[model samples]
Target chain A: MTILFEIKKNYELQKVTWKEKDILVNTDCGVKQIRIWKDRALLDWHVRWRDEVGKNSLAVADRMIRTSEGKPWVDMGSEYLTLHDYVEGTHERSGHEKRWGLLIGNMLQAGLELQEEFSSVTKEDHYSFDACLAAIHKLSKEYNELVSVKNSLPEANKRLNLAMELKKASSHVPLPLFDSDTHMNNGGQIFNILFYRGSDDYPEHGYQPLRRLLTEWLKECGPYSLRKLLTCINEHFSLEREQGYLLLAEILTPWELQDCVVQLKNEELAHIVSYVKSFEQDWDFNRILLHCFTDWMDDKRKRVAL
Target chain B: MSHSNETVNYGPILFQYDLYPEKIEEVGKVKKVISRRGTFALKETSLNEEEASWFTHVIHRLSEIGYHQIVPLYPTKYGDYTVQYGNRTYYLMPWFAGGDRFGLTREEAIIEEIGKIHFLTLKEQDFSPEVVDHSFQYLMQRWESRQLEMERFAEESERMPYMSPFELTYLSHFHHMMRMAEDAKRRLKDWYDACHSEKRYRSVLCHGKLSRNHLLYSHHGEPHLLNFEKAVLDTPVRDLAVFFRKAVHLSNWTKEEGGRLLSLYQRHIPLLDEEKSLLVSYISYPEPLFHSVDLYRHQRERYSQIEFVHRLEKRISAMRHIRDFCDLILTPPPPQPLDTNINTDHI
Candidate 1:
């Protein structure tokens, strides 16, 4: 017995061909061959072509036939085909490139299953991937807005804002990919970049372009919306960070630091004050600047005398 | 002796009162007056109303035995149990001519003196069982209630910012100790109930709070026990445990020195293995009981001095060591009677 399975990509659909007692499907991306026997079916697919850009063309072939009882066999959709092809090609290019491809591939497959279960929208519309990407983008924008607003608030309020940013950041961060049943394979370069740069301590100044993108979207959200967003961040994300900050402050400064120390401290708020102090015996250049700033503030207070 | 009631004076009684003597002269003169009171000795510290009543009871009981450790110059019809100053109470007995106060010249002497006190047993004397049971029950109830109050205070301290982490830890440990004490109490009570029906040992007298102040010495260095205020019918080892803690453990006596003292005590009055085991539990529980009281009182005064806080903190830290010692001594591998007899199959 034999059964026909349709392969569709974008607006293109084709009936895969079969060979002697089997069906063979050949496409530009890969070749998939299928065979049927009494009460059993077998199928195999592999990548076979390169695109015009000299990049390996993303492809997948799923051979679908039937057993003697007419049970349908294999169905590898266009998205899985594209993802698998992308992963294989990326692996050939660089070890790091393959990691991100694998991560995204796993996520995409899971997302596809989830979409199939709940979404009335079909894969033809590409709504599932679009929705995920959109959600991540929205979260990034919200985070950027929170960081900016936090800078404007008082020290106490800053904590709430920072927490908001962290929540937004965490939600958008991609889930790690699995290699086999037990182990996770973090895509090399992509994983490193995400862990290092996408971290809470990532250089906010260095990612100005992304930050600007976030800021633009956040401005459209309105001040009230932004505040509400920050409150949500504080409620969810910033609590641990706030606690860590307070603990650091208490341990570092048993007594109030001198004006010189305070002026020097402000320049490197990047790490905790204790962490900075732990680096060297004497205060560094950044700490000196902070100390000077504090001294100046103290002098100004004395002059006002009111 | 023939007594004439016609204008008989009790001698020229020179009463010397020094609330806080400014100079050694004042104390010296007072001492002279006390010496002149014909067979009299100075009692250190003033007594409160409860202590006075307890002292009165002791003197009255001692008079009935015909040997008055308290010497009254003029024996009134009622006897020598009388108030000296409005604040301080004294009982007059026929004092030995050159009897010395039990002065602890060295730390070893203190432990030895404690051992002497523990050796005292009223094994031959008959006491009212009702009185003994009532007094023992009262103290047990007091201790139990105090533990509960300390626990509640600890729970309250958890919410306080000023409460030191050390204090919080101490309170937690203390709660554990209290639980062990409560367990011991239940077990002991069960044993007591069982023993009551069996009538094996009818009653044993205990000097509840055995301290240095309750001891006296004769010119010949013979030790005499005083102040049976908290005396009641319980295991005599309970008195021994209290004496060991208050006079031996609390003092600067070394473990070796304490062992020596214990040996001396055992020579005078032998201890059963169970009695020795129970001693550790008794010693471990009381210090915390006293400490909890102190903490509660300090909190009441709203005193936040570092010294006071540090004392409480130290006690809290010491609790674990005390508990370990208690467990090492009390919780042997042998299965408890209660544990073995309980019908675990049904429950």
Candidate 2:
């Protein structure tokens, strides 16, 4: 039988059709979206995290719809499939600023609650500034003839040195024990944040292909909006002193420039120049972002001291 | 009693079960949720993290041990037996419509279900002198303190120039209540001595709150137990005492019916002699009567003198029934008259 037929048999649904990539199933309760997963560990983590979110009255993620036998997933031969409430909405970026913060805060709280179960399935954040510096140096040597790549080398080295110092200073700080999903921001566009009428006030913290949500938000949300987001997050889950140090170290690292340098290949000279130009521009933007983080932390420390 | 506004309040919890409520109706401690999915009984209670785990474990453990007469909890789409919403924990079960068995049949069904559970989980505990001594001393100290409080109250009432109706009623039955208290202490000592001598004790999963109200009959007349939130592993006498004490409050209850119910339960697992004494000890305690007086003393302004007197009288009457029941059961039948001629010929 076809996968749709299998879904119908397992979920006891009558009408199930493919809505592009996702399967739209008409359930007795409401319309639902069916998504399939190939990895068992990831599927288990998703089920657990979503279940925790659902239980805690937190509207941070879409809960998995169980099959007739009260299972979160229906097993096929090679893959597993799950259903979720099919929310109809559009992604809006301009408004709902506080709502976005509240959503992320709740997500972090939920993640912290399921830390034990989550830490088993996911890896912690491992950042190395030296790796980025070495990759940049090799790229600069490879493209020495290109003036853009050549000019950006000295500034890139200086930023790496600053990142190294911050990393060394914060070496005593430990990474958070909870599962770290550095992919909360829906890229820079934040398109996964759906807004529909009669929908929940908080939207789902969807998946992202971007490397780190905080770095991306620094480039996209500007310093002020990012501060608002962190402030709201801290309201729900107070950031510890050690966690603040680690976060500051992360902000100091030029992850965007590192990502660009790593992605550079033996493409045409034009692409290399454009890549170097973009990397330079992102590196400058990160400087401002670093300042924003330090400023927020210093202000918070002073307020606490007072 | 359809509550549309309140239905919105319960939406998040019901949504966990994929249930869209068309209406919500409050029934005692539970909410009857009428939904497109089906009708469900949603029980909202408060249980901290540890208590929640224990409560769910008890429910699953009961089923694992082949006790299926319980009202089963429906797992949410997330496969959790309970949904924690704010400080309250909510669980869903298929609503069992009330049947006509509201009287003796219901009580008998409750007793039988309790007996079945006790029989299934009954275990002989390794004799621990520390546990036995602590239990005996703790209970002895608490019962004595309560008994002393009642005595003081009676003395204070006697000293009054003009006694209230509640005071008069309490003073009248004060002697009988004290006698029952002493009798309970004596039985408790006997139980302790028996256990110490035998170096043995048995424990079963006692339904901490046993009442006819906690049992419901299905349409097919099969009774299903509910409210195991307070279930614990304790002496079998704990449950029997709780049940019989409440049973005596029924206007039609007799020592014979109580005896018959005990026999019905005994058919599943017979109570040992010490256990019987413990049961009598738990039942004979005049704690309930003292509660009536304490209520009158503390909250006299809240309730009228007639109300207090009426409550005290009702409890006194119930205690009388318990006393009679205990006397009838604890007493052995008189020795039958011997036929001397027949006995001599046999010898």
Candidate 3:
């Protein structure tokens, strides 16, 4: 007998047909499935939502087929089977950077509307930057002991070192963060918001989705992609000048200073020596990072950056 | 928080390619320099000599194997992929297209491509007895401790008049959790026994992570796999388990659909009974629960009481679905052995 026999019996459906597309092993659940659903209800939603993205509104609700009565989401489990219409098509990964930028802009705009509409919806209080620093402080001892024999230069070591320094650097300088509710601080105080394209489990360190997307566009799309993305952002959203500074900090400093050295050709580096020079306490580690890559940064272009 | 002291000039850099740039613009961390040669994107990063060489080999090998989607890293006129400017290394490549998975046809195509990649990268490694033992020991210790922790939590929950939200959620789903946990332990032990007895396993270049995020589909609808940053030599099942885990995430797909997809993979590179069993065991572990436990323990100071509890509750719901799927996978029909003889390298 098919697994759906039970679900059909329980749901009292006129007719339910589904194809099990894929199976996954999950830590939360031992086994799960990727399914394509065909029932009266989802068929309606799918038919309607086929043109939603083309309609210039990312109204996800149209595509979001509701679950069966009493169920939370489309159930891939054998026992209580339900489904949301599966998005089975392929999205082109490259080209049309301006288009993608516009698309993302639309999404962010839609997200902002949704966020406001669901303002009363309970927010999940996630870890804050203050807490992130504290967590890194607690884990620093473990990182030192866990150094393995990697065949390459361990970027992990550098990340850990930078993360630790970030604790001190961020204390005095407030970072403009993304307003992603998924990745939040202790008090639910969000500074900036940006859409992340990766896994829900992992959020990038800083909230510079625009910067990240711009890099992707430059490398994978066309030269005008960043301009398009910025244009989309400008048309769809608003920002403060300080947020622009945060965006620059999140971006310009590539892991290696030399990557940007050529770009830094003719500029007077901001003298941050004065800022730290006045601070008697808490400025020790921030001072160290400023000196780490001074050789690569010409003396004329020497300036303090957080 | 301060601006860079250096003003970025792309003119001198563009001269390295003997191309006069019409315009040079900052695009995120990289520079978009347009010259008569066409638009080239350059990024500077820190990488050791070995690392760069390995990446070059991997990308080139894939291209050589007819997977040209491994965006060619254009060598400098000096024939170097990386150009050292100060302490940084920069490499430029032709801009390739990127796309996401959409309808069913594309999904099938992407899966088929993965199967092909796995087949091409397949290697027979001598089944290391030490590796098996180490993995088994780690599994046993971790699961055993987790079982203990759950039990302790259960005991405390029973004693308290008012349970924490997480405790309440756990208790509500307690039976499902315990049953699945026990089954996971048993399945792993069975796999360990099979490994010890069979003493034959094949290794393939595992993508480590094969989410839709890494896949790039061109306008012509060809699939391109990206990012070998965390590539590892492991059993083909390592990749399969990851793919499977993600495939079913919040999906309405069934085991039949999953089985069909696996069959597609098997058509390219078959899996042995041992491998299948290992994959099942691998998927059954409550990794999400442990992740939640870690978050709860380490960052309780950061997240509110409701936040953590709600998170756990949501996870518990997902776990229930996983339980059903794992039960089906781990059940009695043994996997058939592949006909072709795959002799792995004796490491």
Candidate 4:
């Protein structure tokens, strides 16, 4: 289980001599550490190596490896790893019923440790949670490689699959609600987290057409039709607890409708409605929602104004 | 105004005056030499009130910033520019004792020194938009007008008496070169237009005509720049390019010397790729050599045919080599930093 650190020609890491297994790269602002394991790709931890308290040494190592070539570096502190897993858990539980509980639990445990670390660092300097998440994803491959070197092949494969699934699921969820003030105080961790989630969940296939329609409609008809749609969903869901499922079925054609019931209950529907309402003024959010639900809309109905 | 014995007397100096002489003195330390044009005066003095005020301000300002080329000479209360003689207009300030004109020994050094001056002046000066635009436009107009004149000259060369048999042969060959120059001028106009339209006007103080005569050397072997009358705010590279054209083309200097001078310029100014390209193309224009040819033709009896042809050939070759030199300048070899004190002979 040997980890191989492949060095690119332009990699700044190559500019300095390092020990075969342990290397430290120092930039003007901070430091990064590289650890080569016996059975995985190189592991990098980056932190604010500047003279500051609560700077995660691991974060420095990650930054060192990620920004080795002077490209933008990521700082995936502990908090993001936990939030990433929490979002993945919510998605996993809602979308599919597999034995993802253990994986989610492990992620939450990691997230809690990250939260603790984040709290300590935020006391001094502020960082965004979204930025933290981005840093985590950026450094995930390297961290996974490090883990792979320590684990047996089958075990490592299982963890790799779980990590990949979590990455995929977390990438599809809408932006989460976090205290912007608190996030700003902690190096914008909250904003970073929300941004990461929003960008990741951005629908792929129908985005452009939906965006065009949304732009035209917003300009031509304003937010009247969007508010009506949300109101319709909310009223219908309030009438009957089970009507949420029925509303989903009504909105989607027979062939398009999923037979499986939504994992989120009426209360969750209310939460989602509130969440969707919060984004009524955001063009990007409206576009994403429209793109996500375009297939579910009735063809007979006039296209949502916008 | 009139002189006794056909000689002019101005204060202590006296000299015989000549309008059209059978033979002129080739060697002399005569206290005064005169021409019918005027009583020739020589001396060391400051500029007149108007000129002095201008030089004092320009030179003093430039000198403060390490530019020490043209120093001010103290003037008498009467405000004359020179002192040794009383007639001819001249300024004497240390005389640049050791320097010779462009073709003298240490030719490369003199060329490079000019390049250094060109680089420095260009780096320091700030020019007004009116000055930059006027000079650039003037040159462009002159080039356009010259193109038409050249075409007429080509046409007249074929007519009787306008061109002698030998002249016709020379004209036929010269026409080819002239046409090349015409094409170059057309291209230069376009380049100038592009530079202007791009708003790439970084004017520098320039010694408008940087010829061998204006560049001098001090006794200590340091290069000294002189003559500031033609100084203006314009493209500094024009000065370097003109010097280059005169040295390599008109003066028939070796390519090795040209290379040395160019290297010195590069070492001093580090020309940008675009500047190098513009310079190369500007020098390639046959207009300068064409004017030189016209001047030589008027003095043809005193010039040798073989020497004239040789000089023309050098200029044409220089014109052709301009593109290669431009490419060389623009795509300079990557910097290889060396330890200042390292001896690399073993390696």
Candidate 5:
């Protein structure tokens, strides 16, 4: 039987059609999006977090539609399938800036709520600044023949040193338990950060997504936009105390620069110049990001003291 | 049944089940929802978190224990038996279309089902003197206090220079009602003593609010019980008393009918002597009379004088029937009076 036939059999929807990647079906209740998942454990976590958050009228989260037998997902030979109510609004940042900021905060808070349960099921990646710096140093030496890369090595070390200072200063601060996917990035011309409902595809616990959000906002929209986002998040849930120090420490660290340098190692000898040049551009971008974040933290600290 | 645009009001609740109600009909407290998927009964209740969990547990447990006579609760698309919106909790179930409810009245079927459930879940609790004493004393104190309140009301009414029709009606039956209350207390004492002697008590999952209205029949006349909101673990006598008391007020009820109903229930689980005495005491208690007087005293403005009197009189009539049933069941037929002429020869 065809995939549509399989879905029809399981979901009992009469009219189903593909809209790009999502399978849109006109259900008796309303239009719904039928999506498939490759990972069962991930899907289980999604279902639990969504169910918990969706129970509250104040918080908005995606809810999975159960099959006739009340199972949240159907097992095909290779994949699992689930259904959801089709949301029509654009996630693009609109005039509702404050609303977007509040939503992001609330969604993160919901993530924090599931920290205990999520931590037990999945292991989170630990970030080691020393290991990252060591890798970058090794990569710069190996690619010393490339002029552009050799020229940027000192600036990279200087940035790493500053990040080390910040880390040492904030070493006493505690990291929050919740970590999930930063759903929006500034890579595109339009920032898609204002979705009305929370996504179910959040990452597992033990890592903080707030740091990623800060880094992305700083890179894509500059320091001003990042400051506004932090302000909005503080309005919803206070992250200005210990959480602030943690985010600043992580941001000041040169994880992205290390990643850029590592990627430079994979280029062909002939293409090495172009790759090095690109790496140099990214390095410069990250340096500006660090200064902007440091300045924001200093300003915040002074205001809090006052 | 009244139909209107109330469908929108319950849209969020029904939407949880992936149902869009095309038509909504009010059937007493339940909303009869007709949707493209099928017809369903959506009951909205005010249940707290704990009570909602217990209600769902009871329903699921009954099904787990192979009892298929209950109306099964349908889970939402998100897989919750109950969906909480605002302050109200909602649950959905198949409508179970009205069937040929001819053979067995709802009351009789309810009693039989109650008995089957009691038989299935009945447990003989370990003897605890403190529990027995506490339960007995608590009930005795409550009954005595209520009786005293009724006595005060009676005295107050008797002192009135001119009595209203309701006052006169209540005054006339007050003495007899008090006597029956005292008799119920005596029977309760007997039950307590029997429990002490037996060194044990039995508890079942009692349908705490037993009435005919809580039961329904399927198309093939299979009884489907619903409304287990007040279900709890208590003496088996609790359900029997609730059912018999409510059943007596029905127009077609008689002493024989009540006896036959009890017998039908007894087929599944025979009532122990103490349990039987407890049932008798519960059923014979004239709490309804006291409730009527309380209503008259506090909320008489809500109803006409004639209405209060009519309600009081109806309860009095039902109490008389209950009295007869209790008397016949509790007091063995007095030893046949000696035929003086024939007995002497036999002696």
Candidate 6:
């Protein structure tokens, strides 16, 4: 609070107090809120978001009021901070979900427009998407090797338990069939390693590159964590329907993220769980997983009947 | 909805209207019937249960509201607005001896009359707010998808060793069309916000296809809106948008000329800032470019390149006019202070 006073700004600070979640400061111009956070990247993302949506009142905060030197934020040695014009209102919590759907519809409409405005932005921000895929492939190989020697190596006991779980989860995905009887073990083959080795249209399955991406996304991505809240607002659909699409996809996957701990870091796992659990109530991910898994179980059911 | 015969047996139709017909003449799609009582024009069109009833209701309502510019002359006989003859729905309207569409004055008068019709059609409805938002969303979705396809096509075409003239044109002007689409979407937001914050959307009885053919001019200096086939209950700005698309194509494509036309229309029916914004958004779309590209892509090798190129050039010229008009509308008004207006008691 004193940092704002010490900044030697244009607007004279009048009254500073806590109004619920925000720290409100009434300046000579108007009331403004000060935002404090730890991560600079998150702060940078916040600044970009504010610039994109601030003017339009779609439940997003308005533009950040620049300091005297025209800087948006002040790196106060330990933490990052910014300022915005305080909007005096409260959320309509009762129908917030429906309201949220409309807000997202608004954002989608806005984003479609913004996409063109942003067309001049040739500098695309690359992500960990491809790297993450490569990491998963490497991890799957390690898990497979550990499982192959579970009986021989005592040190591989903990990893073998995780490998079994990963295998159970991995089998539901029908892919690149093996040519040799030698490769057909009781356990699942390492993902992509065997899959990529097959023909271009491997196993004569209809899975295209986009479908592979989607399957990978469903099996891997939890959600954008914070981006989901903003991006979900852009989805022009009813709350229940979108929530169904998300939960249904999650449920169809065999893994409950318990096996992901050995693969993904603690923060990553937490974020993934945060995304998976964000689905609407009464939607059973396990039941959906069980139902989809029946495709594989149906082969055994007929043989058992025979 | 069904199609009737080329020749209409006027006996049953006259019986319904309770008139005696001596002569009947087929001018175009409509047949002019001269009776002892009066002259009437009957035309058959396809409409389902709801559409027929709604169109009939809107046209009749306009006459009921004392709008004389439009002749909603559906004979209210036998408790029906339409007569089923030869498995087709038919409408019999009072026929007028219309002359050739002459000058700009006549065209301007007709447009002004349409603006009046739009004003008369407004009603307070809550659903309109939602409809505007939804329609805006739907339009954006379509534009976004189209732009994405164009991008994919461009990337693929760029890598090719040889490219056709159409492909060359598409690649060259891709960004401009896309930018226009973006502008349209942005202006749409402005319109949406205005209507949303005001809690009122201007829904009107729009003559969806307004053209010189649809406007019948008489020797006695009187004009009447004839066709009701494509009339719909939508935002009032739609009629203005359609009119401007046609008008600018017919006239010099300039902002001054366009503004004068709007002024002429505003004289008959004053446009709200929101409606003006909505109209700007509507016309900002590169409809001409969309159609030309569509034709080129669909026809591909069969279509003549030079002919298509000429057509594309003409459409692009017209599109440039539309873009210029949008610029006039979108010139940012001086910054307005944040409206502190709020229902304090409710808050």
- C-alpha lDDT values of all predictions: 0.38, 0.73, 0.50, 0.40, 0.73, 0.55
Tens digits of per-residue lDDT, candidate 2, A171-286, equal: 66433322244343331221233221111111122111111555566666677777776676577655546556656666655566556756675466668767777776776776
Q: After superposition, how far is residue A244 of candidate 6 from its true place, in Å?
A: 45
Clashing pairs in 2: none
Instruction: Give the alpha carbon lDDT tens digit for every residue of B1-347 in model 6.
Output: 11134223555444445445567778888877776567888876776656777777877787888888765565422235665433466778877776665555656776877878877877656746667768878988987887777778788778889987877887888888888888888878888888778877657778888886787766555777767668887877888888878777776457778877877777766777887788888887776777777787787676799888878887777878887887775565459887788558875
Q: Mind giving the per-residue lDDT tens digits that candidate 5 earns over B1-347?
A: 22355865675576567776678988999988988788999998998778999999999888888888998899887778988766788899899886887677777789889988998888999989899999999999999999999889888888999988998998888889989998999999999999999998999998788877788888887898999998999999999888888888888888889888988998998888898889889988999988998999999799999999999999999899998888656754469898767756665
Which residue pairs clash in candidate 6? A104-A233, A104-A234
Instruction: Put down candidate 1 lDDT per residue, B98-143, tens digits, no spaces.
Output: 4554554333443454344334434533445565467448757877
How large is the C-alpha RMSD of every model relative to the true structure? Answer: 36.9, 6.0, 29.0, 29.4, 8.0, 28.3
Q: TM-score for model 1?
A: 0.36
iRMS of every model, one decimal?
Answer: 54.4, 6.3, 21.9, 40.2, 8.1, 33.1
Candidate 3 interface RMS? 21.9
Model 3 quality (TM-score): 0.44
Candidate 2 RMSD to the real structure: 6.0
Backbone steric clashes in candidate 3, count: 46
Tell me each candidate's TM-score.
0.36, 0.80, 0.44, 0.39, 0.72, 0.46
Q: Which stretches of candidate 1 lie over 4 Å from their true place?
A: A1-306, B1-81, B84-88, B92-121, B124-144, B162-166, B179-183, B186-198, B201-208, B213-234, B248-259, B272-278, B286-290, B293-304, B313-347
lDDT tens digits, residues B1-347, model 4? 33443232232211111121122221122223344333232332333445534544555556665766453443321122332232233342433346344444555655555555555666533434565467557877777677677666667666756555445545766756666666556555555665555545555666666766655566555556665645666566777776766665545455555666777767767665446646765776676557646755577786676666666666557766654454554466779997799888899
Write the residue-wise lDDT of candidate 5 on A206-261 in tens digits: 32465665555566666677667667777765666655655655665555555655
Candidate 2 lDDT tens digits, B208-285? 999887998776667899998888999999999999999998877999999989988988889988898899999999
**Candidate 6 off by > 4 Å:** A1-306, B1-5, B8-28, B32-39, B74-79, B99-104, B127-132, B152-162, B299-303, B331-347
Model 3, residue B318: displacement in angstroms?
A: 3.3
lDDT by residue for model 1 over A1-306, one digit each (tens)? 223343333203243333322334543333433333221110111111011101111211111212222223333332121211111111122222232233323222333223323232121111132333343344335334223222222432333344345434554332211111111121112112211011111111111222222122233443333233323323322313332233222222211112222333344444334432433322232233233323433544575676
Candidate 3, B190-280: lDDT as tens digits: 8888887988767776766677666656556556666554567778888887877667664665776667677788789877777777777
Better of 1 and 6 by lDDT: 6
lDDT for A185 (candidate 3): 11
Better of 1 and 5 by TM-score: 5
